[model samples]
Target chain A: MIIAVASGKGGTGKTTVATSLALVLGNRAQILDCDVEEPNCHILLKPTILTTDTVNLPVPSVDLEKCSLCGKCGEVCQFSAIVLIGKTILTFPELCHGCGSCSILCPEKAIREIPRNIGVIETGFVKDLDFVQGRIRIGEAMSPPLIREVKTKINRDKIAILDSPPGASCPVITTVKNTDFVIMVTEPTPFGLNDLEIAVEAIKGLRIPMGIVINRSDIGDSSARDFCNNNGLPLLMEIPHHRKVAEGYAQGAPLIESMPGYGHKFKKLSDDIQMIISESYEGASI
Target chain B: MKIAVTSTGKTIESAMDPRFGRAPYILIVDDNCNLIEAIDNSANVNAFRGAGIQAAKAIADRKVDMLLTGRCGPNAFTTLEAAGVKVGIEQSGTVREAVERVKKNEVSIADKPNAEAHW
Candidate 1:
């Protein structure tokens, strides 16, 4: 089963929960970090990367030699990445979505696609657990492409636990899409609750079964729990505020290593998620 | 020489638009400041990205010798330069006033983009 660990607000312990889940599952799981912008799974897991694949988006390259400034290339481009201005054909590579429309529609066939490096996908092994992460090239605005590349590394035979980027944007959606269940990590504070609500709304639109895991559950008000109760979302786990957990995280230690007792808790969380998925499928069939 | 002034309205009497790419209208005028055409730029104005580049292309297609606007971004500036169109940026007032300023060589043509890209 493919499960995505996501949160709308940053610093809500998504990486913490994700890493722990992967650790608990061990050889039975492959953790894919889809947070291309800032992947922290590697920091926790410290996987020795076996292979690094550079991901590229096919941007348009114009051959002015074969040249006719037919304006069709400009007309077909929605992002205005390629435009025919007077006798000059200008291409802004940064604005290109790598849609290849400009090249395909060019009657003169003056446009061809060239590889533009957007990011890299690194695959490695963390002990018995398989590890994969995508890191976007610095200053690269587009990350959905790279996130999609990371998801391609998902092993169907193993339980894929994806550590999604923070937010309800395209990157998070791309990571969460096609998952069997989503475990949304959140805090009990107002900021966490607000963003979690937004994220839950996005997940609801996708019609995916999701549950909440409230980190630092002891400090903040009970609003997060109240929200889950009102929305019929299962409160999967509540990790109380703990100094040791924080220090261990800062030292790049996985949650399971910091607090060995939580290993069983994470395992239970996975089992609960599995049961929910099965029940949903049974309900759908009936 | 045909000149285009970014404006908020169709006529030369209208206020000059400070924005280049997202300007609502572009009023084309002759050397003597006679209104030739008013090109609606709503498409570029509402564009999600690369608004300046598309707007520059539209103006270049009109075969304008000069463009008088509030500011020019890098992509738009580069496009206009490639089209051999002189850009006179940071001109504000009525469209007619901007045209008159350029006619008298009051506003200097920019060598590089005066502003960052809108995108």
Candidate 2:
């Protein structure tokens, strides 16, 4: 199943949940870190990357010599990334969303599309589980393309554990859309509860079934759980605040592997999720 | 045109509307730097992750010619430059002061992305 593990707020243990699930699921699973801007799952997994692919966005290139500055391209571009002066068709590749609307609407055909590298997607294997991550170029801001690139590395046979970036905005939406299941990790804090509402709305918009996992459950009350219960969303797991876990995290280690006693618990949670999603797809194992 | 300005919170309050969502509020301003809207979008502009597109449509709608703010990321800087909008920097005061400088054509843009990293 394609499971997107997400949290609207940063440092809320989304990566911890995603990587641990992948590690426990073994060869049956793969993990894609779609947090291209500042990906961190690879740091903990320490996978030996086997392949690397560059992610590029299509941007308009203006031919000043042959162009009549009619501003048609600019008019077509809702992004305002292209502006035509009296004789010059100015194109801003960075702001271009690669929608191809400008090129399609260009009457003079003076604008050609070119690839601008925005990021790189790398694939590796951690033991039996395959791993993929998108590394955004230092100056690039468009992460949706890179996230899509990272997702292309998924092997359908393996459990696809997607580690989404922290937000409820477009990037997070792009990562979470069409996933078989969604697992939202959150700390038991007011801020976590606040962002969780926005994330819930996004998932609802996608019409996808979702569950919750509470990290640092001991720090705050059960508001996250309360919201989930009130909303009829399942509360899959609640990991209490633990100093050892923090120490393990600081060392870039997976909790399931580091804390031996927790493996069965995570496995059970995985099995439950698989059972829920498996019914939806024929012959898919839970 | 409506413009989203990203700046230090200390000065943003004086010049922008008060609305908190994620973190760095997306201050929607008109051509005159008058507060028109505010959105919470710390993730979009926090480290300049997705500022260009997030603010592009709003600015385009306002017919703004310039984005007067503190620091801009490289992607946003180049994007705005290509769209023929002048980007100004280093002016610390109320939003009115920045708008005044923009009107006078005295504000200068950085050649590169000017955002400071939170890390």
Candidate 3:
């Protein structure tokens, strides 16, 4: 089963939960870090470098010689990446979505797509656990493309845990879209609750079964927990704010490594997710 | 020479819109400070991305020789420069006043964009 660990707010322990789950599952799991903008899963898992693939986005390259400055290319482009001004057809490669609309709609056939290096995906192993991560080229506006590249590394035979980026926007959606279950790591704070609600709304539209994991559960107000209760979303785990765990995390230690007691709990969490998915399937059929 | 002043209103008497990409109106004026045309730029104000490039294209479409605005971003500056539009940045007050200042050679043409992209 493919499971994604996400948080609407940043620094909410998504990497912690995701890496820990991979550690507990050992050889049975593969963790794919889809947070291309700033992937942190490798920091926790410390996977050995095996293979590296450079990912590129195909942006339009206009051939002005055979070109008709018919303004067709500009008209077809929705992002305003290419515009025909006066006698010149200007192409802003960074703004291009790589949709190929401009190239496909050109009557003169003057536009051809050229690859622009956007990011790189690295795949390796942490002992028996398979690890993959996407690192977007700095200053690249788009992350969904690179996130898609990261998801392509998901291995079906093992439990794939995707460590998603923060926020309920395109990147997060790209990460959690087709996953079997999503574990939303959050805190009890209002900021956490607010973003979590937005994220839940986004994921709900995707029709994926998701649960909540409240980190630093002992400190902040119970609003995040309250939100889950009112929304009928299951509260999967609550990890209290402990100095040892924080210290261990600061040292790049996985939650299971820092606190071995939580390893069994994460194993149980995985089992619970299986139960939830199965129950949902049964409900859908009925 | 035809000059385009980024304006908040259609008339030349309106206050200068500080933003280049999200400006509501771009009033085209002559060297004599006469309002020739007003290009509505409301569409770019709500654009999610590439607003500056779209607005630059709009300005260039009008065949303006110069642009008088409060600030010009890198993308808009590059597009305007390509279209042979001399940009006068950090010009405030009424659109007519800005045009008059440009005609008087009081406002220096910007050699580089004053603001960063998306500013």
Best by the DockQ measure: 1
Best by TM-score: 1
Clashes of 3: 0
lDDT of 3 by residue, B17-101 (tens): 9898999998998998888988889988998777888888888988989999988888888889889999998999999888889
Chain A TM-score for each of the predictions? 0.99, 0.94, 0.97
lDDT of 1 by residue, A138-159 (tens): 9889999899989888999999
RMSD of each: 1.2, 8.8, 1.5
In order, candidate lDDTs are 0.92, 0.76, 0.91
Q: Which segments of model 1 are wrong by more than 4 Å?
A: none
Instruction: Report DockQ per prediction, comma-separated.
Output: 0.84, 0.07, 0.77
lDDT of 3 by residue, A200-259 (tens): 999999999999999999987989989988999999999999998999999999999889
Q: Report model 3's chain A TM-score.
A: 0.97
Instruction: Say which prediction, candidate 2 or candidate 3, comes out ahead on TM-score.
Output: 3
Best by lDDT: 1
**Tens-digit lDDT string for candidate 2 (B1-119):** 55455444533355432221123555556766677765555554443323454454345444556666665655455556656666666655566666666667787876766764221
